[model samples]
Each structure stands twice: as C-alpha cells, then as structure tokens.
Target: MKVTQIPFQKIGFFSKTMLDYLEKNPKINPFYNNFPDFEGFQKQIAEKQTSFSKSSRLVLAEALKNQYESFEISEKTKTNISLLKKEHTFTISTGHQLNLFTGPLYFLYKIISAINLAEELSVKFPNQNFVPVYWMATEDHDFDEINYFNFDGKKVTWNRKDGGAVGRFSTDGLDAVFDVFSEHLGNSKNAQYLKKLFADGYLKHHNLADATRFIANELFAKYGLVIVDGDDAKLKELFIPFVRDELEHGTSFKAVSKTIERLANNYKIQVNPREINLFYLGDDYRERIIFENNLYKVNNTEIAFSKDEIFKELHKNPKAFSPNVIMRPLYQEVILPNLCYIGGGGEQAYWLELQDYFNAVNIPFPILLLRNSVQVISEKQARKLAALNISKEELFLNQHELITNKVVENTAIETNFKDKKQFLEQQFLDLKEVAKKTHISFLNAVNAQERKQIKGLEKLEKRLLKAEKKRQTHLVERITILQNELLPNQSLEERQRNFSEYYLEYGITFIDVLKIALKPLELQFTILEI
Candidate 1:
C-alpha cells in the first residue's frame, strides 16, 4: 500500500469549528481546556485521574467483564478489560450507531483511530496503560440511520418496523438482509469468510448490540479493541447523580445553552440542549422527557410523573431514564476512566458545546480527537488517476471544480480569464485616475461601468468554459467516472461505501494496510492506494 497525507481542511469534509479546533485557535481555547496533543494528554491524564473515582472504575470493570462473558474475545481484549480496574489505566474511546454490516467505511476508521491512539499513548507513557474502546450507541432510537449500509452501489438494508432502542432490536429480519448481501458479495474465500461472519454475527446473535459486538470484535480483537454497550443498568446507576441533577436543576440546559449562545457568535452549534436532556425509556418506546407545569411528561405520550413520583421511579428503576445527546457524553465519562474521545467531524463539533457542561457538573472533560479519516483506492484506480494527471490534492476538490480544473489542464483553449480580468481592472485603474484628475462628479459612475464590464466578462468567461466542456465531452466523462469511483454520490468514500466492499477484495489484510498507514496523532486525511 502507498499512502499520502493531506490536511483535513483541504479535504472540504470537515466543519469550520472542527478545523478551528484542530488548529487550536485561541478563540476556541476558552471552550476546551487542553488541545489534543502529546502534552495535552499529560494534563488530561492528571485531570482524569483525580476526577474518576476508584469505585466507579471497579464498577466499570465488572460491567465489562459481564458484557464480554459470552463473546469469545481475545486474551488481549480480556487483559484490556481487566486493566480497566487499575488506577493507571485510561480509555481512548470512539462510538457509533449499530449500522448494519458496519454502515459506512469510516466505521472501521473510527475504531482504528481509537485503537491506534491507545497504542501510541502507551508507548508515550510507559507506566500508564491505555485501552481502546468502542462504545456502542445501543440506546439510540433513530432506526433509519442504522438500518442500512452501502454495498456495490446499493443500500443493503434491514427492512423492519423499528421501535425503542435499536440495540434491543431483534436480528430476525437480518437473515433476509444477509441473503441479499451475500448475493452481492461474490463467491471467493473472502466472500465465504464474510458470509460466515454475517451468519454468526446477525443470524445467530439475539439482538443488534450482540451482532455488532461480534462483528467489531471479529475484525479488531487481535488489536485488543474492547467494545462496550452503555445500556446496562449498572452503568445507568453510575449516571444517577447527573440524571437527578438534570431532572431537578436542568443543569445541561443552563450550561449548554449558554455555551451555544457564545458559540453561535462565531460558529454554527451542532445540537441544542433540552430543558431535560433525559428520555423516558420503556419496552418498546423511548421518548423525550419534558418538564412542564411541575410535571415530567414523556413527549407525545400519556405518561406523566410528578417530582416525587419521578424521584421514586428513578430510585427504583434508573435504567428507565436515558440520556439524550447532551447528557450522553457526561454519562460516558462518568462510567469510564476515559481521557480522550475519538470521533468524526460532527461528533467533535457537538463536543465543543459540552466543555462548559462538563465544567458545571465538575467532571473532567475528555480531550476530543477527530477520528482518522481515509480514502482508499485500488491500484488500478490509482493508475488511472495518475495517467489522467489527477494529483492527490485534486481529488479533494468538488466534482464540478475538479472537472473544470482538469478540462483547463487538458484543453488548448484559454479557460481562465483571471489575467484578462486583472488587466481589465488595471485599465479601469487609469480611467479612475483620469476621472479623479478632472475631479468630475462622474467618478463613481466610471467605477460602476468598470464593475459592469467585469461582470459581463465573468459571464462570457463562464460561457467559454461551458462551450469547451462540450467540445471535450468524452474527456470530461472519463474524469467524471474516475471522480464518481473515488467519491460515490459526490461524497467522501468513507461516508458512502461500506468496508465489505473492500474486505471482499482484500480481506483481513485491508485492515492491516490501514493500520500501517494511519497515524492517529498526525491529524490529517489519509489517502491509501491499495
């Protein structure tokens, strides 16, 4: 495999807030305590150690031990789970919804980033132990988002009427999905392996959570990736204090609302907080809990509880209360001795709004690291790209811009009017000088005419490019096909394609190639030629 690194901003896939945070802009420093760097980890380690209690650590370890009881995990993963009980151990975690067949290609990248970061951190701090964790978003209720994955330019989906948390969703409908998926995956050794993986993971497993755990562990068990499902009662018990605070004081609302107000001045806020960021969860229902008229009611439901009634319910059944996006991060931090969170652009953006909440709750905020993103191209495709003279940097441009650039490079016609526009403006400079010399009242009029002429030239230049594009339609089509191959639906491959697309071709070595190429702390986009 050959690899190239490009800055995330250059890729045009990240948000301004995420890019700004990565650059460590002083304006963002007030929102987050430490920049995610080597030295930042040192400070975060000290802070997390003081904040994460020993009892919580013990509970977390026991919970993991129970969670992994049935799965045949590697000894390395077992050791990592055992290490969580130690005071010197810290977790580097990345989380995702349980998308079928590991939805997008970035799913692998996110876990790989966490696993690689833990390994790097261990090498840096020899005395400390770092464990990679994949926190399953089992409590997520948005079934549509996690129901399908793209394969062979098609969405292989689990068609079912979904209700409640997706983790608890049955794998019954998945056998049909697996049959459809197997049809697309051609018969090869890798294909057979995938079939068995899907069969054992989904058909044999009882629920989505277990199926996802089996798949992830099958892929990354050798690397010691410990997967955790947060929908456990014992884990919910750890978050009782925050849940109680949210119910009574509306603490996340106060803190996150203020932070959003401040962040809105310079950046777009990803998520707005609710007055109560906890949801009332039932067997087949998960609804937002809204406090109104001194009564807590589940949204769109007849369920209502007074303060005393709700308090009693919470004490008896804390698992019934689920944290929303705002409080979920707090819950994750409270349960694990986590030092850093590895996530995608959107994940990091929302996390930026939470440091104030973490401060208000007096919990140590985990250092947020954007997960490693990769674009993988086959050797044949790489050769085609090279033959077309498309540079790695050129691939990041928007579809239209990339085609226009290539057309300009390939055509003999002058596609750019930049120099001509400059010269025309420079000529207007003399006209303005002449108008000024006469001191005429028509100076503004002269500038207006210049602007009009420039606008006309711009229109004419666009027309010329359009005409040229038609002349080189075949060449343009080739470039379009290439671009579409690299970026499906004009979006990042990692966002559109599934790992199975490559795993069928390269199998297990595909991951090994990625592990070799990905440098977690480098903080750049990776392009891999496989």
Candidate 2:
C-alpha cells in the first residue's frame, strides 16, 4: 500500500467482437437484469433447478474437513451455521485460491465487488435482503501459482515443501512465508500491519482453510461477507448423482464439448475442450460414490453420498468429498440460490464456456457480469504534464507524434517573412515593368536582389526552427522517458501491484468517486489521463 504514481492510458484488452456485443446491447445491463432483487432472485433469475446441459447436470457441494472425509466437524464452522437454508437469502460469491494470506489487491477486488454489488442490489429492492459469499478454490492442485503474491516489483512467496489440494495442507508452514514477506516490506508503515494480520491468521491457524478465512474476513468482515470452503465430504454427497452420471455415461465432457462447438459457431470464437470429461474424482471414487453407477468400490474417502442426504450433514460433517469447478458451482447453487455472478473479464470468459456444462447437468448457469477496472493518476503526474505545457492525453499518444506536435505548437516563426517576400516579388515585377517601359537595364539586378532576399528568409526560418529544437531538447528527453515508462513490453496499469499509487493522488475515496462517475455502465470510450 505504499504511495506511488498511476500512469493513465486506455486499456484496450477486449476484442472488436466484445466491444460490438457491448455496444449493440446498450439497454441490457447484465448485472442489474440478473440480480436486481434478493427475494426469489435465485429461483427467478438463476433458474437453479433447471439443468445446465441438455444432458442434465446437477449442483454439488463437498464439506469442510478433507479431500473426502466420511465424518468430521470443526467447532468454528458449527458455530457459524445457518438453519437448513429456507427460502430466498441474497448471496454474493467471489472465488480465490486458498492463499496463506490474502493473495493480492486482485483478491480484495473480487470480494469487494461482491460486497458492493450486494449493497447495490439491496438498495434497488429495499424490501428484500442480501448476503456475501466467498468461494474458496480449495480443491485446486496448482500450488505453485497460488503460493505467492506480488508486492511492488518483489514477489512474496510461501515455500511449503508438500503440495496436493492446498486445503489439505497444514497451516503450520506459513510462518516461514510470513518472515520472508516481512523482510521484503522493509520498514513501511503498513508493512507491520500486514505482517501482524498474516501471523494472526496463517501461523496461528490450524489449516489452509482457516488461513484463507482469516485474511478474507479481515477485509470483508465489516460487509458481513461469509467465506465457504467446499472441500467437505458431506457437500460432495449432494454432487453424487452428477458424479455418477459423469462417470457412467461420460455426459459432462460430451455435453460441454458440444456446447463449446455450438458456442464457437454462434460467436466465431473457439474454445478448447477435452474429449474425456474433466470431472475426475477418479473412476475408483465414482464407483464408491453410491451414484447408482454399475461399478462397486469401498467406502472410499472420495465419494460415498446417496441422493437422500441432509443439508445439516453437509454443513456439519462436510469433510466428505472433493468438489471440482464443475461440481463447485453446483454446490453454490444448491447451498444458496444465487442470481448472477459479477466478475473480471477473464472470469467472465471462463463462465461463458461453463454455461453448456451447467445446462447438461440440470443446474442453471448464473448470469455473468464483467467488473470495472481502473488506472489512477496522481496530482504530481498531472502537474508534470502542465509544467511541460502538454496534456496527459498527449502523454498517452505515441511518443514520436507527441514530440512532433509539441515542436509545431511551440516553434516561433516570423509571419512577416511571407509578407516581406511577397512585397519583394511585387517590387521586382514593378521594376521589370518600369525596365520594359524605360529599358531592360535594371531588370536583371532587380531579379537578383529578389532571389537573394528569398534565400535569406529561408535561412532565417531554418535557424529559428533549429533554436526552438535546441531549447526543447530536455523536454524531448522527458517525453522519451515517459514513453519508456508507459509503453514498456507490458501494460503499466494492468500489471500494477499496488493501488496506493493511485489512491495517493485520487484519495482513499477514489473507488467511490469512480463508482459514481461510472455507475450507469452504458457510457463507453474512456481515455483516463493524468
């Protein structure tokens, strides 16, 4: 959160098709359409009971304790329990890896978007209610990626020697990671606070689930955002039928593949699909899943859930099954009916691909909305442009073009030179007319003098231009430096590690100001400048 400067420029990451789709649908505000109200929003908007794929996909949920636990309940989860979730409660879901500490500003943005959107939904429909949900990416095996977060140019990494589904990893190893991160903070004011938060959550906690919870709760506790880890066995029980169908008939993979093909035809954009169903709780686990599959396996740890199950069992003894992406979404839908999902561009893209899979499984695919992203510019950066007598928009322009335009704007040229030259030509013409009347004697002399004057003016103009160029050499260097900073190999704003640089100039309320300025999301073509 250290202060720095935010360089402003347009981030044109979307394709022409995306822009066109957005532009053409001017009246259709996706988020508002889907999640305008909390009361019956899930049932009405999401169509949770509806099948996702033509093949009939169902929603699934796994419990808290293990990859697949038969019976276990943590006291903490029990204390935070809700009644067998009766009708229509508002829900906001944001996903994050089980980062030992909250991963990055991106993580903050995800949960923040959920909270903000939930608030917006509540206001729009004052009669209803809303709540926040954080979905933990606990079953994810990609430990290397979520193991670190970037701070400024430095990387803060947690080097846990063991790796599987990170949820299963013990939280004891996070202290070393914290120590390394603390050293990198190097005496910043907020560094100590961040370190304290990490220690209290990760080091003092019992597991990765607690670690994720503590960090997320710290940021979103005020907003009443509750976090859920779907790695529980009882939760996976709900997913049993879907797991059985996927294993027996191989429906998920087949259904998703067809959907992707059809989507590509519709949108003219290709999506990658695996021939084999990506739902791999394993064939072994699938048999033990009690899914009505033909195969028989032991009361194995992965799946042993029948269709007739209780919500309390999933909530209490959740350490039973492993929930993958396909199953996880189902779990969310089953646990709490949700109307829509507000997420980033990449997240939206992935969701589009999942729609077919949802349809096949008989679970409704929630409406997806792309969230707002921004680049913040500081007062000092604005002043730098003002001092240079150039607009920051010009800073965003190509460096060479900016310089050329600056040269033309600032160069001093004598307007009288053109008039003087014309006068000399007129004088020569008059002299020639006189010569013709009297004699051809001084005509040559007049022409010679006129030529000399023209040459002198041309030289004078060049000298003046040269002087202006000399005067502006340092300014040109600054522009070059600006280009180097702004137009590097990667995008400046997209890759920025900290939001403080923007906040330093725009104040802590910048996000609020942006929300007001940007709320009626129909306005397009932003050229944010310093």
Lowest summed-lDDT stretch of 10 residues in model 1? 26-35
**CA lDDT, candidate 2, residue 341:** 67
Model 2 global lDDT (CA atoms, 0 to 1): 0.54
Off by over 4 Å in 2: 1-10, 15-21, 24-84, 186-189, 266-271, 275-327, 385-489, 492-530
Could you tally the backbone clashes for each prediction? 0, 38
Predicted structure 1, TM vs. truth = 0.95
Candidate 1 local lDDT, 295-352, one digit each (tens)? 9999989999999999889989998999999999999999999999999989888999
Cand. 1 Cα-lDDT: 0.91
lDDT by residue (385-486, candidate 2, tens digit) is 677777644655656567767776766754236787788788778877877776565777777777898899878866766666678898778766655554
By TM-score, who's the top model here? 1
Per-model TM-score, in order, reads 0.95, 0.64
Please give the RMSD to the true structure for each candidate, in Å: 2.2, 11.3
lDDT of each: 0.91, 0.54
